[model samples]
Target: MNDNILNTDREELVARLIDRPESFTDKQLEQILADDECRALYDTAIQVMHSIEPKLETNVEAEWNRFSMLHSRYRRSQRKWWKVAAMLAVVLMSGLAYATIQHMKQETWSEQKATESIVSDDTTTKTTENKQDTMQVQTSIAQPRTFENTSLDLLVGVLAEHYGMRVQVMNDEAGQLRLYYEWNPALSIEQVVDQLNTFEKVNITVNDHTLTIE
Candidate 1:
């Protein structure tokens, strides 16, 4: 019974020293460790304390604070990356839109220039055609042509078309009169009338740009 009581006292003292090492003075601690059983119990307690020393000293709150800080930094980095990506996307789209508009403008200008060129070419072609028509009329009047036994009406019709004149016959018989003549287109209508006046039974005259036959 006394051994049991001594062992219980040694166990309690070792437990109390482990909880609070300053609880015993050095003299009292030495006195308690003087017993082999009490010293053995104290050595076992110190070994247990050493074995679990890292777990006892660990700071759970400090580790949690470090983890939270790391998480916050990771989130910030992700947001920064997303912002950079968004900025790059916006710049790329704007460049493409600008390029498309510029290309369209260039195409419109090219089309306008092409249309202007076509219109200018058409205008030049119309001017050349008008000039050609005037030259042909003048050349036809300046050249000479021979009529072989042609009717007076046919001759007068041809001359009127070239010289812009009106013709009249005193009677229908004069229109049917056939003549073989080499026409001098350069001669005036009055001179031609005088020449026709010398014909047998033919009289021609001109007045106010009109030619009359009798």
Candidate 2:
């Protein structure tokens, strides 16, 4: 087509001719049909537009399907990850609870053992004191005498002075002297034995509360 003719009001006519070749007036139609260049340009533009239209449609459909598949997979992957995270959280919580329970159980057992030990030690001390008092009362009337080279009275006196114990020495009907040492609630049996054993001449026997010295 002539550039001037294409630039004038013929552009719309040219577009219309391309849309429908049989719709133009006879004169305009004759002008377009006689110009081989214009006719060839129009035919070529129409063929190009037609060829691209289905490919464009197919490309759009394919892109939409790809986007949908990607979106669906992303959502499924996110859900799967969430489930795994939730399971891990549950396992961590369970482990923490189990460890806490075990720790508590061990603490409780340790406390129980400590309490029992204290009670046992206290009971033993009280029993030793009670027996000593009974022996002292039984021997209070007898006269003090010597046995095993150390006088019973001297042994009792030393215990009284050093350990705050009250001791009494007496002789039984068999003429054998018995020494009764006074009990102290605070004194341990081991402590009492240690003190008495310091004097090698005396032989000592520790009953529940009483320390018998010969």
Candidate 3:
């Protein structure tokens, strides 16, 4: 239809494109594509015609048998659809049951862990409280002895006697040195000796209950 390119209707163009593609010259095809609406219509007609697949040679008996076979299969599947639906229901119920059981197990395990944690915390708290109570009782038992301006010789004599220790004075000056100090009986004898040596010109040490002063 190159002779009537500008005047062709939709039917004429679609018929020629589907049935007689060779009827279109390159120039005529370009002219059709150049028109946007005509090109869209042309493409749509090709897709629709190819999809429908018009039968050129009809085998009547063969077509009938094929249609009957497809219709029979469809009917069979329709009748058995209830079986498939029942199987899916059973599978879903089993999954839900398994999930519920697993959820229950998880909750039980979590509760056990929570119970154990609470018991552990209680045990630790009790242990810490007992240790603190013991320390407080020990501190209360030891009464500190204070000597304000007491002579070192007398102080040393009392402390040595309390611990059943022997006292040695290297010089009379060191033995007679007066001191203001608080002696805690709570401290070990060695610790008391160390504190005494902190004073000026006081060198003292205790070994095996023997208090040595130099």
Candidate that would win on TM-score = 1
Q: Please tell me which model should have the higher TM-score, number 2 or number 3.
A: 3
> Positional deviation of 173 in candidate 1, in angstroms?
3.0
Ranking by lDDT: 3, 1, 2
lDDT of each: 0.71, 0.57, 0.73
Worst 10 residues of 2 by lDDT: 141-150
- Give lDDT for model 2: 0.57
lDDT of 3 at 157: 86
| Candidate 2 structure quality by residue, lDDT tens digits, 1-214 | 4433444454565677878876656666777756766777677787988888764335877677645532343455577787897899799889978976996676567557757778775556556656865776445423332222234556555545544555544433212333333334245556656655543354555655455554
TM-score result, candidate 3 = 0.34
Of the pair 1 and 3, which is ahead by TM-score?
1
Residues 42-86 of candidate 3: C-alpha lDDT, one tens digit per residue: 888778878998778989897876454423434455657868877
Question: Who is ahead in lDDT, 1 or 3?
Answer: 3
Candidate 2 displacement at residue 119 in angstroms: 11
Q: What are the TM-scores, per candidate, against the unseen true structure? A: 0.40, 0.20, 0.34
Q: Which candidate is the best by lDDT?
A: 3
